[model samples]
Target: MKIRAAVLEKIGAAAPYAQSLPLRVQEVELDPPGPGEVLVRIRAAGLCHSDLSVINGSRPRPTPMVLGHESAGEVVEVANDVRDLRPGDRVVLVFVPSCGGCVPCAEGRPALCEPGAVSNTAGTLLSGERRLHIGETRLNHHTGVSCFAEYAVVSRRSCVKLEADISFAEAALFGCAVLTGVGAVINTARVQAGSTVAVLGLGGVGLNALLAAVASGAREIVAIDLNEDKLALARELGATMTVNASDEGAATAIRTATHGGVDYAFEMAGSIKAMELAYLITRRGGTTITAGLPSPEHKFSFSPVSLVGEERTLRGSYIGSSVPVRDIARYVDLYQRGKLPVNRLMGEQIGLADINAGFDRLATGHSLRDVVVF
Candidate 1:
């Protein structure tokens, strides 16, 4: 069947927003679901930082690609071989999990499942091909679902069923930013009550981290951001203190406020300096979690002595150690309890045509998240 989607023809090209260069909306073709797969009619999708990074050439990806990864929808059809998932079921898309019996999944690390290892890079299932097209060229596939389109064919392992009454846009966030941030705090760090915490960057992922720290009973949640608007959003998301990193030395400011350092620091923005600050702000023996995705070309510099003497440990996290089966449900319950503030995270909403505009919002780093509805 044919599908409508936003296609990024190449890197460094402007999305539908400024010029007709790398990104634009075009009608494309889609394949039917394969075995162990389900066809999802996307209700809503999010314009996340990673999507923008790929477009800006920070995160290089195949061109003529369908741009969305964070999305939620109802299952319109499920393959004959697929079980446990049926038509009419509401679900959130996850590109990182393929099999529950894999080595990673068996160790309670579904996010590291091997079979779907490079789904975002390889852009397809085991067949190793995409189902989208622009004119004659095969559009490069991204994260199997490529949910920028109205309909997507995805493996059953890539989706987590959601409860009714939850907005698909909000559910879509659980796929990426929300999962990464909240999972970093709750799943990876396992922050204890009254733990002093600091978060670097107040974008979608960082805001979710801020909220999760609050839910974890953190005593003080210090948020840092170069943009004041994002800092304001961070405060709304449950930050107890805010730091403007534009002109001020953020690390020094955090140190001043916390009277030395915090027990835990999380880096959500993909900045090398910010990652260093996350390390610097941790007290002796304090843990620092790096949740940002730096470009392949970027690298950080740190001294060997700092790691050994400060007794501080720096760790990296991808997708926040999220376990879809258990954590997605737990977060949904938190949302329903009015604790997660899922509604407040909605910065803007646009149709598939306005998809490029949503990308602009993400580039400016102002909103918690922008939704692209099909």
Candidate 2:
């Protein structure tokens, strides 16, 4: 079938993406779902930083790929031998497609599924096949979910069913922002109630982390970002404090405000500078978790003595270190109970044709979670 999709032919294009137009919306061919896969009609998808990373050549991946990962859609078709899911079910697409038998899956860490990582790096589905084509040219999948298209064929493991009442836009946020941010707090950091916490960066993911930290009963939630508008929004979303990271003395200011340092500091900004600041603001023996995906070429350095002497912990979180099957439902339940309040993280809605402009807004920090509503 032919469907309209956003295709990124090259990377490292100049900014003002509306002018550069890194992603071209074009009609492309899609295959029916193969075994262990399903065909989904995308209803809504978010323009996330991970997608931007690919377009800017920061996080390198094979080119000529359909570049969406965070999306919600309805199942239109299912392949033979697939069970437990059928047509008409609402589903959110997860970037990682876990093979049940992989070591990480067996160890209850589907987010680290070895085969999923391999497939993502190779730009192939879990089965090592390409299902999208442009005339005679085969296109690569984006993290097993090339969902910028109107329709996508993805592995069954890439989707999780949603409740009937949840809007596609709301479900779409869960696929990435919510899962990664909230999971970073609850799963990766396991932040204790009444703990002092700090979240660096106020993008979609950072805002979600702020929301989750609040829900976790964090006593002092400090929100840091270079954007003042985002800082204001964070305050509205229940952040107890806000800081502008652009200040040269920002780390010193944060330490002073927290009365020494925070118990936990989370780095959501994919910048080495932000990671170093997060580390600096964490109290001795405190844990600092980073969910940022900086380029492989970039590396952050810190004093080795701090790790051994202070016994401080630094960790990286991918996909929030989530076990999607177990965590998505739990997080959704929190949303329904009025605890998570993820709805506040949503910004504006756009159509598919406005995608390049949407990306421009994201790059300029002019928007939060911009959903492409079908």
Candidate 3:
């Protein structure tokens, strides 16, 4: 079948993506689901920074790739050996395609699945095969889910069936932002009720972290970001305080506001500076969790003595350390109960043609969660 998909032919073609237009919307042929894979009709896809990183050459991936990962769709067809899901089932695409037999999967850490990582790096499905072609040219998948297209063939492990009432846009958000942000708090950090929390970089993920902190009953929630608009939105969305990270006195202000420092500081802005600031604001024995993905070449340093003496813990949270099957359902239930208002994160509704412009806003930090509703 021929489907309209966003194909990135080159990386870093130039910025203000609207001007450079790196991702060309073109018609491509897609294959039917193979064994252990399912064909999905993508209903909605989110514009995540991870995709932008690839376009701008900040995060390197194989070129000529179909780039999209966070999405929600309906299963249109199921291949042989796939039994748990069927046609018409609502599903959210997971970036990591977990092989159930992997060591991490066996240990209930599907987010760290070994085969999934290898397959993602290879730009192939879990079966190590490509299912997309542009006439004679083969196209690589993005994180096992090239969901920017109208249809996607993905591994069974790449999807989580959703409840009937959840909207595609909301489900798509669950695929990345919610999972990474909320998961970082509840799973990685295990933030306690009445704990002090500070989240740096108020983008979609950071805001979701703030929401999770609020739901967890945190006494103090400080939102840090360079954007005043985002900081204002953070305050509206339950942040107890806000700080402009651009301010030189920002660190001191945060320390004073929290009476020294917060119990947990989450860095969601993919930057070494943000990580350093997050580390600085964490109280003694507190945890600093970073869910951001900076360029592989980027690195940050820490004081070894402070880490030892203060007992400060630093950890990286990928996909929020989530087991999607379990965590998505739990988070959705909370969303239904009016606890997690992830809907507030939605910024714009756009068609696939406006994708490049949407990306420009995303790259410029002008929009939160822009959705391509097919």
Q: After superposition, how far is residue 339 of candidate 2 from its true place, in Å?
A: 0.8
TM-score of each: 0.95, 0.99, 0.99
Each candidate's lDDT (Cα)? 0.82, 0.92, 0.93
Better of 1 and 3 by TM-score: 3
Model 2 Cα displacement at 170 (Å)?
Answer: 0.6
- How well does candidate 3 score on lDDT at residue 176? 94
Q: Which stretches of candidate 1 lie over 4 Å from their true place?
A: 14-17, 134-136
Question: Residue 83: error of model 2 in Å?
Answer: 1.0
Candidate 1, residues 1-374: lDDT per residue as tens digits? 88888788778865555555456677888877878888899999888888888888898877778888889999999889888888999999985755778789889898887777766677665346566765677876677768888898888888898875787888898888788889999988889999899999877888888889999999999999888987887787788998876655777878888888999999999989888888888887888998898898899888778779988788888889888878888888898898887667777888888767677767777766888876
- Candidate 3 stretches with Cα past 4 Å from truth are none
Candidate 3 lDDT, 40-90, residue by residue in tens = 999999999999999988889997999999999999999979999999999
Clashes of 1: 1
lDDT of 2 by residue, 195-302 (tens): 999999888899989999999999999999989999999999889989998898898988998997999999998989899999999999999999999999999999
Query: In every candidate, how many clashes are there?
Result: 1, 0, 0
Which scores higher on TM-score, 1 or 2? 2
- The TM-score of predicted model 1 comes to 0.95
Worst 10 residues of 1 by lDDT: 14-23
Better of 1 and 3 by lDDT: 3
